[model samples]
Target: MSLPDDTRYLKGGPVAKRIMAEVARDAAKATAEGFPPKLVSITVGDVEAVGVYVRNQRAKAEQAGIGFEERNFPADLTAAELEAAIHGMNADPRVTGIIIQRPVPRHIPIKAIQAAVHPLKDVEGMHPASIGNIVYNELDLAPCTAAASVELLKETGLDLKGLEVVVVGHSEIVGKPIAFLLMSEGATVTVCHHMTRSVAAHARRADALFVAVGKPRLIKADMVKPGAAVIDIGINTETGPDGKERIVGDVDTDSVKEVASWITPVPGGVGPITVSILLRNTMVALARQRALYQATYGTAE
Candidate 1:
């Protein structure tokens, strides 16, 4: 869909590139300092959908000069056994971060696996402590998608201080964290969930709006404030009239772009930036680990 000249489409490539460049520089410095960052991915069972995500992560990690390792566990492995492996990685000084791939076999609880990863090594930011850090304004180790969405907002060059922001979605990973991060930046954030009385009413009053609900086209042009910056963090697959599958975001981009001053396009927006943010978190984890090592052994190693 072609965008109107009045609206600016926020592409993730340039932002991701800028961030990855910084990460690569930091990674190279860390490598020279003998504290290179390494990320370990834990995948349970065979999930075809997850394989694509893992490949992308590995490619981006390599670009950032970070080590990537994939550890595939048996589908039938008990949760306790999986947690033991995660604990082992937590205790391994070589492993800088841990990523738990989604859609593990129904038998194992995803949250349980996330909890097993130590907070210092939870680069994915799924751990409870990592999320809690955002509440206290410790923004370095936030969830990737949430951090990327905020990064895109900052790219608009609007002053976040005292800006009116509406977030349509309250999931722990995306919406809630985004609210906290923005508030930490001094933006007044209103979070709307399924039970909100009038999401559109709140959305239309914001200077900056973010939508992360799974429903496609949930935010129309009418729902957005004119000249507002819209960040669509939701990824949904929809089949067109011709039966071809396509990825889309929560906002109706074609229509919303006409109203919004800036908007992010699905498949080219937050996805790429999210991967870069993951690598950034890896460096943060590595820095924290290096501090601990220095305190304990009087050396970065």
Candidate 2:
């Protein structure tokens, strides 16, 4: 299913393009009706990686016919101060979606900050209310990373009903949500974390494996069932042969690709799809915000 050069890649490029095209159409429609979708990214620190991610979202938003803005706050800013800023955005009629970048100052609680973003504008889907919706199979507003992983599995033509899925992380953001989403689709799910005894043992049983534990090369070929679909959601930086930096997933691609039926390359796989989903969520938020606006003003656009 792939060239020898790319290794049965479940590449996100094609999938993301298709999804973005739909987002663009909806975005255009929203704008034509006078409610242009707008996304706001809040960062409380100068994290380099977070900066790159925000910029990428900005570019993607522009391409999708959505308006985007980023607000950077000093690391020394108090939690209350940041929450106040979020409150301001929450009340803004033009802001359709809100995302709080991670790695905020240690004193600031991310959960509380994310909670401050109105659920209607929580485009990243990190708010407790937004994530809770997944329990009821409400995926339209599910977390972007988890949604991307599910989409990647679909590319393999794997039947979600009664399929075996192993997720090797337990974090609230990526791991837990992906497992819940898989279950909603009727996949039998197993979640393994740092505390999970013999992580490889659990992973070996999966018809589809999702790895997002952040450890590099944590899932190897020996741990994957033959012909299984593998989705590596981990992004790790490592130095390669020339001593330059390279990004890789949790799975050992060279080894896993030999045995797996389909695999996603770290940089080009789930990452693109996640960003696209964020934009798509923005469009959803746009519609929801428009409803609220219309109800308040007695005007339909």
Candidate 3:
């Protein structure tokens, strides 16, 4: 049976642009007072997709009036080099926030690199300290994409409290943190992984479902509960009939849209919001630092 065409799409790009513009205004005020906000992104290797993502992030940071720095390492660089890069950014006073793009070189140890970044500057929220803050429900900056997921839901005017939310995938960046954020918002969250027994069963019972397994078309129509809100965070590329590749998300959008009450389309949805959240985090960091500075000194002229 064909699913119902009752889906509500959440467009994130325009919302992100608007939010960043606000941040830019605030940043301008701070800079006029002699304190400038800055963000640095560290990337290893030259993976095409990762490069594109980082470039977009840098562009957004610049447009937001946040200082942007790019630190590039060779593909064959050792883990120690990556750690050094993080340490350098951590020590740089000009850098208010730092982000390390994922899918680092296979030979590099991500855990070690993540540990080297100072918790304050780890704007991507991948550090253990940041995760601990999340676990303890502290007022620390959350992982950007995870926070963006919550923002997307709220922007849709949906109430999250007491909802049955199911998240597929167990990645530290998107899956686990998002579950924590949803739970913190008072939603009953169930986290499923690649090996979960009957993952579809769990998904079918959700009031809201977020999928980020990085597999194209992983979440099918039947697996989604009727009227459930589905957020697809995966971006996978596959070769088309003409030998070119196209980007696709976890949900079978065409079919799932019929069943879901609300959904996020891949290209226009989560990607933009995630970048927006990163800028927001940078703004937050800058504001806090500015406040501390003002308290130490006197108000600017």
Best by lDDT: 1
* Whole-structure CA lDDT of model 1: 0.94
lDDT of 1 by residue, 1-301 (tens): 7777878988999999999999999999999999889999989989687989999999999988999999999999999999999999999999999999998999998898899999999999989999999899999999999999999999999999999999999999999999999999999999999999999899999999999999999999999989999999989999988899999999999889999999999989998899999999999999999988789989454
Candidate 3 lowest-lDDT run of ten: 1-10
- Steric clashes per prediction: 0, 0, 0
* Ranking of candidates on lDDT, top first: 1, 2, 3
How do the residues 1-301 of candidate 3 rate in per-residue lDDT, one tens digit apiece?
Answer: 3345566787788778778888889889978977788887778888576888878888888888888878777898888877877787787778898877778888988788877878777777778988888888763478887887777777767788899999999899789998888888888999999789999999999988999999999999999998888888889998878999898899999889888888888778888887878887777777766666578796777
lDDT of each: 0.94, 0.89, 0.83
Q: Which RMSD does model 3 reach against the true structure? A: 3.3
lDDT of 2 by residue, 13-113 (tens): 99999999999999998889888889888888776868788888899999999998888898899999999999999999888988888888899988888
Q: Is candidate 1 or candidate 3 better by TM-score?
A: 1
**Which pairs, if any, clash in model 3?**
none
